[model samples]
Target: MFGRPQLVFLLLLLVAGLAWLRLPGDEQRVRTALIMGTLVEIRLAGDPQQFNPAIDAAFAEMSRVEKLFSSQLAESDVSQLSFSTEPFQVTEESAALLQRGRQIARQSDGAFDMSLGALKQLWGVETENPQVPSAEQLQQALAGVGPEALQIEGRTVSKSNPHLQIDLGGIAKGYAVDRALEILRRAGVTSAAVNAGGDIGLLGSREDGKPWRIGIQHPRKQDELLTTLILTDRAVVTSGDYERFFEKDGVRYHHIFDPRSGYPARDCQSVTVVAADVASADALATAAFVLGPQQGLQLLEQLPQVEGLLVAADGTLHRTSGLAALEP
Candidate 1:
């Protein structure tokens, strides 16, 4: 699982403060709540009668997923599994997600990992005193972590080595976004957008029958815009070195890490991926960031319904050939 910030949004508006341009009328409804430690905003268009109920269901789903998968929570499903000595039985949904995490882990060759609990602790990225761990500590952190440490057989999951510490933060938020949109769709929503921090998923189109507009935030200059994308019925996720980092001796150590090395990935300053679902996009964003620009672009090009934009550590820009068509 990955931890990421929210994306900017809607018609070039900055969503940092949740300051979406509000539409006053019965046609559109917007709601915001703090879920998964991020300001999640849901905008719905179409039937007014279904707005509140759909938003309610979507929020409920996100909260449920967070409670089940959050690594920080002592009682979360995954957290319990992390500390369990014996095989743990989980819900069908958790099983599916764990399996999906494994698939993505293998696909990215451990770049997008679900087992980074110890690594996260070693880095202390979320704490006040985040320091660079020693080589021994980093090696210790990598013990039994990655796709191999995790085992999922239907509803049962077990750790191959007890030293494994699993964290689903990489996949949870995006999976929540996907599930939320799925709920909205099931409720017969004609058009809707779910923006969790910046990992976003869309359904149908905007109220004006135009494609939804999303902004890719500039990594170094957080306040500035990178580029705007015109999209609909898709999801986009961005992972960057600029988010959640502390500078030490002129080097910025960010939260996103390479599971293999137990260190922050340095290949790209930022990587944005667009895919049919937020889960895939989120996984790809982190993978691309770790794989570097060249290999990352190759990975994206090999996949259908996926496009990526990468800002290399050397200040070079690389992107899929088709990404230009989505911009103005």
Candidate 2:
């Protein structure tokens, strides 16, 4: 779930020519690495000598969060969270993120759910082999899809149903990107941007002080720009059926699921959200997609400082009030 950062980065330079270019010692330093199961590309504009260390610390924090949230790591709390019936004590960060996720779930009427491990596993969209599950299997998984089953008291998190599986795939990536920016800002970097997969967060403008121009990828067209948004000091995220999917009998199944139905959310081809923070935008993008265009745009309109653009199943585009888009 992310806006096209490379597109934004390149366009930013082209839009502002060499006259404002580089600015000498305050040159931008970009580094990309495989972290948290995605390509995390960091752009920092300042003296490389200082920002380089900040990048190290930023990636370190991201790596830490990745290991903490990854289910494959036997030592991670998430690995034990799903099946454990006992009151499990997770780190404070994990608890806080879980609570925020639950709040979003409540606000969206289960449109965005964190406790979808069962449904996700049944579909296996991200796995080497993905398949559509039987109706009976979907019904069984749907029973464990609600966030109401998750109860968090301080750092202690437990589930009413011991079999409930909790996974915060998109939201956690957003959180990691936020954490990375925090580390960069603390280092006194003047301007920077961090793109984790498709989720992106910005700390400041480019060398020209203009809002960063980010392009939204066309849901049905690869390498095509659907639209663009000018943003600064904010995060933008896109959740789309095109990100991950499988087709069977001419039916396209994607990874974004509606907990209410335990199937791929088919109301929209994609949904993009912009907010003050990436985590909220990331989760809300998925929420809006599942809610469909009408209610999805309504939910986006109701939220303060949140905006969204939804591409409907019919290839029509809908957006919330106050979202400014530049023509592609």
| Error in Å for residue 175 of model 1 | 0.4
Lowest lDDT block of 10, candidate 1: 1-10
Determine which window of 10 residues in candidate 2 has minimal summed lDDT: 19-28
Whole-model lDDT values for every prediction: 0.86, 0.86
True lDDT of residue 319, candidate 1? 83
**Deviating ranges (above 4 Å) for candidate 2:** 1-28, 325-328
RMSD of 2: 8.7
**lDDT digits (tens) for residues 286-324 of candidate 1:** 888988999888888888889999999997889898899
> How close is each model in CA RMSD to the real structure?
10.2, 8.7
Off by over 4 Å in 1: 1-28, 47-49
Clashing pairs in 2: 2-198, 2-199
Candidate 2's TM-score reads: 0.90
